[model samples]
Target: MKVVEQIKAPILDEMETFEQKFSNSMSSKVALLNRITHYIVNRKGKQMRPMFVFLVAKMLSDNEKANERTFRGASVIELIHTATLVHDDVVDDSNMRRGFFSVNALWKNKIAVLVGDYLLSKGLLLSIDNEDFDLLKIISVAVREMSEGELLQIEKARKLDISEAVYYDIIRQKTATLIAACCSLGAASVQPNSVHVEKMRKFGELIGMAFQIKDDLFDYGETAIGKPTGIDIKEQKMTLPLIYALNTATDKDKDWMINSVKNHNKNKLRVKQVIQKVKDLGGLEYAEKKMLTFKMEAIDILQQYPNSDYKSALELMVNYVIDRKK
Candidate 1:
C-alpha cells in the first residue's frame, strides 16, 4: 500500500470526520474569502499533518476514543499549516503550489496576505473556543520557530555562510517544528501525561529531521520531483550535502565551489558541476547516513509503546519520511 494509504487505514472513519470539521473551520461569511477557501479545500494536499495528529492521538490514548478535542486539535494544526503555505508562496514569490496556482498568484499579494492572516486567526480562535490551550501553546511555538528559521536562512543565504550546525537549526525550525507540534498536539489531545507528549514531540522531531535531510539530498539528484534539480543551489540555499562537500573539499576546490554559487549560480552548467562535485565528494553518502540515524532514533522511540495498528502506522510514517521521493 501507498504510504498515505497505510497511515490512514487505521484512522479512516475519524479522518472523514476530521475532513468535515476542517472544512467547517475554513468557512467564512465573506463571499470572496469563502470562494478562495473553497478553492484551497478543493486543491488540498495529503493532509499529512492532521493525519499525524490523529494517529498519534489514537496510538497514545488509553481509551482510544477520538474525542471532540482530538478533532479540534487536528483542525487547528491543519489551519496553521495552510496559513503558513499561503504565506510562504507569497514570500517565495512562487506562482504555484501542489500543482495549482498559488493564492498569491490568483488573488495578488494583499489578498493572499489577508487570507493567510484569516486562516491563522481561525486556528487561534478554534483553540480558544475549544479551550485547547495546550494545543495552542504547542502550535504557537512552532509558528515562532518557523518565522525565525526563515529569517535566519535568508540572512545566511545573502552571504552563503551556513554551517552544518546552523543548517540543522534552520531545518528544525523551518520544517520540523510544526511536525513536532502535530505529534505533541496528538498526545496532548488525548490528555496523556506530559512524558508521553514530550516523547512524541521528540519522535516527531527526529523523523522531521530525517525528512528534511532527504529533501536536501534530492537537490543533488536528477530525479523529477516537481522542482528541478540544483534548484536549491541556484537559489543559493546551503543544504547538508553541499555543506558537507564544501567542508571536505580542498581549499582551491572550496573557493571554486563558493565562487560558483556566489557568481555562477544562474549558469546551468555551473549548477550541474556543483551537483556533480557534491556527489563526488561523498556529500550524498554523509547526508544519507545522518538521515538514517535520525530515522532509527525515531523508530526506537516507537518501540516503547504497545503494538497496535496505530503504532504500526506511525512507524510506517517514519519510514515514509525518509523514503518519499518528493
Candidate 2:
C-alpha cells in the first residue's frame, strides 16, 4: 500500500491541533523573539516530532483524554525541536533553514542565540507547569545528548578516517535520540510502562537513524528536492554512506577520495569534484540500501503490536520518513 494511504486522516487532524498549540505558546514575546518565532512558523516543516508523539499515544490509548494529553506533550516536543534549530543555525553559521532566511542570518548571531534561549525557557516553563517529572527528565536528557552529539560531530567532521560505526553513533545521538524520546514520552503518557515505552522508543530510534541517513544520502543520492547534493562532503563531515564506501573502496580510490575531502577548498568547483568522486565510489547507493534496511527494521517492530489504524499509521510514517521528497 502507498505510505500516504496508510496514514489515517484522523492522526493528521490531531497533528494540526498540536501545531497550533505549539505555535501559540511561542506567541507574546518581544519583537525579536516574536519575529523569529513567526519566521520559524512561516517556514514549513513536516511536524514529524509531534506526529510521532500522537501516533504512539493513539496506539496505546485512543480515548479523548489520551489524545488531549498527547497533543500537549507533542507541542512541547515541537517547541524543543524549534529551540534546537534556532541554536543549530547559529552554531553552523547557516544562512537558511527550511528554505527561509534563518534567524541568525536575518538578525545576527547574538539575537539568534537569545531567541533560542527564550524558546528553551518557554518550553521548560510549560513542561514544569504540566507537572510531569518524567517529561521534564526526558527533555533534560535529550538536550544533554544533543549537545554532546553536536560536539562529537564537530570534532570528528572532515576526517576521512571516520568509520561507519562512528558515523551511525553520531547520527543516533544527534538526531535519533530526541525522536526516540518523543515516542517514549508518548507511550509513557498512556501506559507509563517500561515495555511498551521501550518498544516504541526503539522503533523511533531505528526509524530516526534511517530518516537522517536518508537525509545525508540525499547530499549524494538523486534528490527531487532543491537540497544541494553533497553539502556534507563540502562541509567535510563523513556520513555513513561515505564511511561505508571508504571502507570498501580500492586502495588508490580510497586515497584519492580521502585527499579530495580533506584537501578540497570550500569552492563550488572542488565540492562538485568530491561529489562526483563519491558517486563514482558508490557511496550514495550504499547509503540508500542501508536506509531501506533501517526502514524495514522499524516496520518489523510494529509487528509486535495488534493491527490497528495507529499501528498502520506508524508503519506508514516509517516509509514517509525516509521517502519524503523534501
Candidate 3:
C-alpha cells in the first residue's frame, strides 16, 4: 500500500469512535443526523488532521494509554475538519468535492449550513466528555482561527488587490491553524514541556502551509487535482501563487490577468490565457520552491523526536505534500 494509505489505517479506527460518540449523543429520531454522517463517510477526506494527532501522540509516547488519548484527540480533529468542509461548500457554492456532489449540492444551502452547525456542536459535546480542558482549548482556538481565516478570505475576495502576505495569512489561518492544533493537542497527551509542544506546533504549521500552497498550485496544473482550476480566478479570489506572481509580473501580463479574472463572461479562453501567463511568469514554480522549503522545515522538527516508525511516517508525510496530485 502507499504511504498515505498506510498512515490511514489507525486513523480509520478513530473515525469509527467519532461516529459512535456522535450517534450516542444525538437526541432526535430523525434520519437527518444519519444522513449527514453518511454523507461525511462517503466523502472520505484524506483525514490528515487526525493523522497528525495520532502521529504526534505515538512519537511522544508509545503506550496504550497514550494511544487511547490520541484516538479521542484525532476524532475531535476530524469532526472539526468535516464541519469546515460542510460550511465551505455552501460558502463557495461548489457543486462537487472529492469528485462527488457536495452536501450543499444535494440538500441545498439551508440544510448544509445547519448540518455544519450540528457537526460543530456535536464535536464540542464529545470534546467536553473527554474532560481534557487543554484539548478543548486547543480545538476552540482552532475554530476561532478557521473563522478568522474565512472572514479574511471574504474581505480579500471583495477587493481585487490582494497582497501576497495577506493571501498567505488567510491560508495559514484557514488551513494551517487546525493542523497546528492537532499537533499541539497530540504533544500534550505525552509531553508536558512547552518547548516540545511549540516544536510540534511549528512542524504542523509548516507542513500545513506547504499543503495548501501545493493545493493552490495544483489548481493551475492539468491534473485531477486541478479540477477547480479557474474557480478561484472566476470567483475573483486571489490565491498565494497568483498574488505572488502579480506582484512580480510585467505590467502588461498583470493587466491581462486582471481583466480576465475580473470578467464574468463565460469565455474559457480568457481563463486559459491568464493561466498561461501565470505559468510563464513562473508562479507555479515559485510556489513549488516555497513548498519544498516548508516541507524541509517540517521534517527538521521531526528530527528532535526519537527515531521510530511514527516519526519516520511524519517525515514521509512531509514529502507527500508535494507528491499528492489530488
Candidate 4:
C-alpha cells in the first residue's frame, strides 16, 4: 500500500470525526472571519499533526477507541498549527501556501494577523472549555519552542554562522517540538501514563528531526518540491546541508560560500554554485545519514509498543517522513 493509505486506513473514521471537530472549532460569527477560516480549512494539507495524535492514542489506549477527548486534543493541536502557519506566511511575506493563496495573500497582512490571533485563541479556549489542561501544557510548550526556533533561525541567518549542533537545535525546536507534543497529547488523551507519553514523545521527536532534515535535503535537489530548490540559500537560511558543507570547506571555499549566501544569493549562478558545493563536499550524504539514523531510532521506539495496526501505521509514517518528496 502507499504510505499515506497505510497510515490513514486504520484511523479513517477518527479522521472524519476529527475533520468535523476541526471545522467546528474554527467557527466564527463574523462573516469575513468565517470566510477566511473556511478558506484556511478547505486548503489544509495532510493533517499530519492530528494524525500523530490519533495514531499514538490508539496505540496506547486499552480499547483502541478514540474518545471525545481524543478528538478535542487533535483539534487543539491542528488549530495551533494552523495559526502558526498563518503567522509564518505573514512573517515570510509569502503569498502562497499549500498550493493556494495564503491568508495574508488573499486578505492582506492585517486580516491575516487577526486570523492567526483568532485561531490561537480558539485553540486555547478549546482546551479550557474541555478542561484539558494536560493537553494545553503540551501544546503551549510546542508553541513557545516553535517561536524560539524561528527567532533563532532569523538571528543565525544574519551571520550565516550556524554550527551543526545549532542546526539540530533549531530544527528540534522549530519542527520536532510540535510533533513531539502531538504524540504526547495522544498518549495523554488515552491514559496519561508517563512512560507511554514520554516514549511516544521521543519517537515523534526523532521522526520530526528526520522530517526537517528531509526538507533541508529538498533545498539541494534538482526537482521542485512546492518551493524552489536553493530557496533556503536565497533566504540565507543555514540549513543542515549548507552547515555541513561550510564546516568541511577550505578557507577560500568557505569565504566564497559565505559571500554567496550573504550577498549574491539572489543570483541563480551563485545559488547553483552553493548547491554544487554542498553536493561536492558530501553535505547531502551526511544529512541523509543523519535523517536515516533518526528514522531508525523512531522505529526502535515503536518496537517497544505492543503490536497493533496503529503501531504498524506509525512505523509506515516514519518511513514516509523521509521518503516523501515534499
Candidate 5:
C-alpha cells in the first residue's frame, strides 16, 4: 500500500465516519448550493487536514475513539479550508483544482465567490452551534494568517527581494498555520487545557514548514512533481531554494538571476538556466537540509507520547510531509 494508506491505518474508522459528518455539515437548503458542495466533496484532495485532527485526537485519547468535538473540529477545518481554496481559485483565476474543474470554472466567478462565503459561514456556524469556540479560534487564526501571507508574498513579489526570514514568515503564515490548527484542534478536542495541545500545534507547524519547503523543491525538480520547473521564478514567487541561491551569489550573478527572474521569466531558456544556476549554487541542498531539520524536530515531539498506532501514524505523517514526491 502507499504511504498515505499506511498512515491512515490507525484512523481508518474515524476517517470513514468523519466523511459522513463532513458531508452532513455541508448540507444546504438551496439545491444549487448543495450541488456545488457535492462537486467540491467528490473532488476533494487527500484528506490530510482531517487526518491530522483524527490522528492527534486518537493518539491523545485514552480509548482511541474520537469524541463529538473531534468530528466537529475536522468538519470545521474542512469547511474553512474548502472555502479558502474556492476563494483562492477565484483570486488566481484558476479553472482547475486536483485535476477537476474548479467551482468558478463550472459555475462562474460570482457564484464561486458566494459559494466560498457560504462555506465560510457554514464553518463558523458549525463551531458556534456546537460551542467549540476553542476550535473556532484556531481555524480563524489560520484564515487570517493565510490571507496575510498571500498579501505579504504579493507585496514582496513585485520587487523580487525576499530574505530567508521573509520567506519563512510567508510559508509559516500561508501553509503552516492551518496544519498547526489541525494538530492543536485534535489535541484540544481530546486533551483540552493541557500542554499537549500546544505541543501538537508546534509539531504540526514544523511538519507544515517542511511540507512547504518540499513543495518549493518540486519547482527545481529531480522528478515529475506535477508543476513545471521554475514556475515559481516565472511567477516571481520567492521560494527558499531561489532565495538561497540569490543570497549566496556574487553581485554580478545576483543581478543576472534577478534579471532572469524579473525580465526574462517568460523565456524558457533563461528559466532553465536559472533552475540550473540555483542547483549549482547549492540552493537545493540548503533547502533539503532545512526541510529535514523541521521534519526531525517534529518527530522529536512525538517522543514524549507513549507508543500507539496513532502516534506511529503521526510520525509517518511527519516523514511523509518531507518525503512526498509531489
Candidate 6:
C-alpha cells in the first residue's frame, strides 16, 4: 500500500465518515455554489489535515473513539483551509492547483473571492453554532497568523534580505500554524482541559516546520516536489537554502545573488546559475540538517505516548512529511 494509505489505515473509518461530514459542511442553497463546491470536493488533495485531527483525537480519546466534536473540528479546519486556498489562487493569479484549474481560473476573481468568503463564514459558523469556542480560538489564531505571514513575506520580498530568524518566523506563521491547529484541535476535541493539547500542538508545529523546509529543498533539487526546480529563485521567494547561501557568501557573490533575484529573476539561465550557487554553498545540506532536526524533535515528542496504531500512524505521517516526493 502507498505510504499515505498506510498512514491512514488505522483511521480509515473516521476518514470515510469525515468525508461525508466535510461534504455536508460545504453545502449551499444556491446551485452555482453547489456546483463550485462539488468541483472543489472532487479535486481534493491528500486530506492530510483531517488525518492529523483523527489520528491525534483517537490516540488521546478515552476509548480510542473520536466523537462528534472531532469530526466537526476536522470539517471546520478543511473548510477554512479551502477558503484560504481559493483566496490565495486569486491573490497569486494562479491558473492551477494540484493539476486542476483554480477556482479563479474557472469562475473569475470576483466569484472566487465571494466563494472564499462564503467558505470562511461556513467554517466560522460551524464552530460558533456548535459552541466549540476553544477549537474556534485555535483555528482563528492560525488564520490570523497565516494572513500576517503572507503579508510579512510580501514586505520581506521587497528587501530580498531576509535573515534566518525572519525566514523561520515567516514559515512558522505561514505553514506551521495551521498544522499546529490541527494537532491541538485533535487533542482539544478529545480532552478539553488536558495538557496533551499543547503537547500535540508543539508536535504538529515541528512536523509542519520540517514539512515546509522539505518544500523549500525541492526548489533546488532535480526532482519536482510540487513545483519546478529553481522556481523559488524565479519568483524571488527567499527560502532557507537561499537564505543560508546568501548569509555565508562573500560580499561580491552575495551582491550578485541579490541582483539576480531582483532583476534577472525571469531569465532562465540566471535562475539556474543561482540554484547552482545555492547548492555549491552547502545551502541544501544545511537545510536538510535543519529539516532532520525538526523531524527528530517531533519524533521525540511522541516518545511519551505508548505504542498504538494511532501513534504509529502519526510517526509515519511525520516521516512522510519529509519523505514524500510531492
* Model number with the top TM-score: 5
Q: What does the lDDT come to for candidate 2?
A: 0.79
Where in model 3 is the C-alpha error above 4 Å? 9-29, 222-228
Could you tell me the lDDT of residue 167 within candidate 5? 92
Which portions of model 5 show Cα errors greater than 4 Å? 224-228
Worst 10 residues of 5 by lDDT: 221-230
| TM-scores, all models, native as reference | 0.97, 0.89, 0.88, 0.96, 0.98, 0.97
* Residue lDDT tens for model 5, 116-183: 99999999999999898988998999899999999999999999889999999999999999999999
Candidate 1, residue 187: the lDDT equals 91
The global C-alpha lDDT for each of the candidates, from Candidate 1 onward, is 0.91, 0.79, 0.77, 0.90, 0.92, 0.94
Ranking by TM-score: 5, 6, 1, 4, 2, 3
Q: TM-score of the candidate numbered 6?
A: 0.97
Candidate 3: residue 268 lDDT (0-100)? 77
lDDT of 1 by residue, 1-326 (tens): 77899889999999999888899999999999999999998898888898899999998776656989889989998898899999999988999999999999999999999999999999999999877888899999999999999999999999887899999999999989988999999999886557989998998899889988998887877245544489899889999999999999999999999999999999999998998899899999999999999999999999999999999999999988887877
Tens digits of per-residue lDDT for model 6 on 1-326?
99999999999999999988899999999999999999999999999999999999998876656799999999999999999999999999999999999999999999999999999999999999999999999999999999999999999999997999999999999999999999999999989979999999999999999999998988877355443468888888999999999999999999999999999999988998998898899999999999999999999999899988999999999999988886
Pick by lDDT: which candidate is best? 6
* Residue 185 miss distance in model 2 (angstroms): 1.6
lDDT score of model 5?
A: 0.92
lDDT of 2 by residue, 61-157 (tens): 8585345557667767777778898899998899999778889998999988988888888888887887766776776788898888888888887
TM-score of 3: 0.88
The residue pairs in collision within model 3 are none
Candidate 3 residue-wise lDDT, 1-326, digit = tens: 98787765545555566556534443346698677677676567666776788778877875743455566666666676778888999987999989999999888999999888877777787768877667777888888998999898888777678887887798889888888998998897677556777788888889889988887876687366455366667767787778877888889878877777777425777877777778877888888888899898888888877888778778778888768867
